[model samples]
Target: MKTNFLAAAAASFVVAGASVASAQDADAPWEQSPFRCEPGETYVMNVMVSGVEYWFPVYEMFKQAAHQFGCEADYTGTPEYDVNKQIATFEQALAKQPAGILLHPMNPDPFVEPINRATEAGTAVVTFAADSPNSKRVSYVTSDNAREGRVAAQQVAEDMGGSGQYAVLENPGQDNHDRRVAAFIEEMEDNYPDMELVGRASTGQDPNKAYQAVLSLAQANPELGAVFMPEASSAMGAAQAAKEAGGDIRVMSVDVNASVLDMIQAGEMFGAINPNQGTQGYYGFLLLWLAKHPELIDPMNDHAEAGFNPMGIPVLDNGYSVVTQENAESFYWDKYLKKRGTRGIEG
Candidate 1:
């Protein structure tokens, strides 16, 4: 179903007022759950990014969780968004053979065998951010990407009155981006038949390319009602292009960058989906660490009569948030910043 953006934005203040009047509870899960690790327990993490702001918070969260668990953590990744490079890093991580490895697989297929090899070699392995769904990885930590896409599409369709031309900004051929786009298109086709998806362009997570894509779409289809970007960098460019064009096109995207949050607060952006990057890193590592030490988790698994460690699940749903002006203040980065220090938010 579609949502009324104007109505939601307007009512947010009222809802905030009501919640404040009702209760002042401040207990969140992150604050309650203790970090699970032991002293001298060393871990290594490999991410997939080229120093983008999006991935840094995730790393920081992972580090913070590692600290809480009394484990040492290290993060390194490629300078560019290259699957081959990420694969090489994964191989290198296997070489160092730390207690466990947290990886964000670049592709869904090629990383499967290597991840299996890592797990078989007894190096507790888990996937984060993105996953190789077919691999033997212990846990897959990430926001529900498909659900995020479906939500974005539903919101866009509702905002546009369920009819009009729309476009998508994708991250080249990335599997995560592909999954999101596919879900969005499927949602539109199955539910909002009146909404036409006219264009799908790749921005490569570069602002200029994103700008060009949105600019081209707006120029080609002046009637374009909304645009959804699955990546944060491209979302920024889409907002700029939408602003420059001065059209009715509403913008929606994924992730929570400081600037993006500000834009959403100022009503410049329609809304943003926050996958809680910090939590992803924190929990991704926790699962891997726990998998390595079955003693700690065996009780819960055995009590529930569950199977052995790793769970062998196809995918793990980390979580996501639909951030708007009303709740932006509550979702601060202090916890992540405190652990990562200045370095945490910088990247």
Candidate 2:
């Protein structure tokens, strides 16, 4: 009887050992894991408006990519709109010596030196949503801002029958915002000659400022048919002002949030251009990781002569979608993720 008990215990031990080994193998990094990053190697996603809802999915995707490749990921930045403060936060992130960084620079000028410094320290960096072209960052990933602007303008102008008075709510200093505004204006002038731009006001990153700007513009240009802003924060206020003014002015902009999606669904907004933010974060990390360890994807020829450096792929357009009332339900980040069988940040 004692011999039978010992044999059963040994069998149980072997089964437990096999279970442990299976678990470890399941958690092992994928075959293509870049650099075979050391166990503690970390990556970070840094941005200016860290608390914004639009960025939640971006960071979530970044985290998911890190998890897949067997690395740690973190988020750090300032909620303020100050470029200097964002630069300071960036420098702080650098002190951690992360393996790579994904940055959403608040302005083009302030990030040039910090990005160069990070790259010099052998930390890979990639810019997304906004960029510093003069910086030595590995790559810039985003929707084509100029094309998004042109598309938004075309949607509004065509909806208005190609003839209407419109006003712009601008965020003047941001490189991406400025590009969108410029393209919108050019599209209007060249394609919709009947559309007149009556006024321009700087909202800078404030929704209240956008609200007041729209109110004043509507007062001045009572015949205004539409108002376009480079981003969605301003759209919330602009929609409210248009509703309060009892005007038929259509509100259009770029980017999406729950509020903006709700507005579109209720017909309070004309439409929005949503850049594939998840793709931006996922590929941004891929670029940064590749830049850190180019050996993972070596090519046959010298890349410099081929004009196709692996570390930096130049600009990658993640593409965009125009969201209207008919399809606004499909663009909310959380709902979109749920439909794909994935949980966002919290998961």
lDDT of each: 0.74, 0.83
What is model 2's C-alpha RMSD? 11.7
Give the C-alpha miss distance for residue 83 in model 2, angstroms. Answer: 0.6
Candidate 1 stretches greater than 4 Å from native: 1-39, 295-314, 330-347
lDDT of 1: 0.74
lDDT of 2 at 201: 96
TM-score list, all predictions? 0.79, 0.87
Candidate 2 residue-wise lDDT, 92-204, digit = tens: 99999999999999999888999999988878889999999998888888888999999999999999999989998888889999999999999999999999999999998
Report residue 168 deviation for candidate 2 (angstroms).
0.7
- Give model 1's clash tally: 1
What does candidate 1's lDDT look like per residue over 37-67, in tens digits?
4456678778677576667777776777677
Model 2 worst lDDT run, 10 consecutive residues: 2-11
Runs of candidate 2 exceeding 4 Å displacement:
1-35, 297-309, 337-343
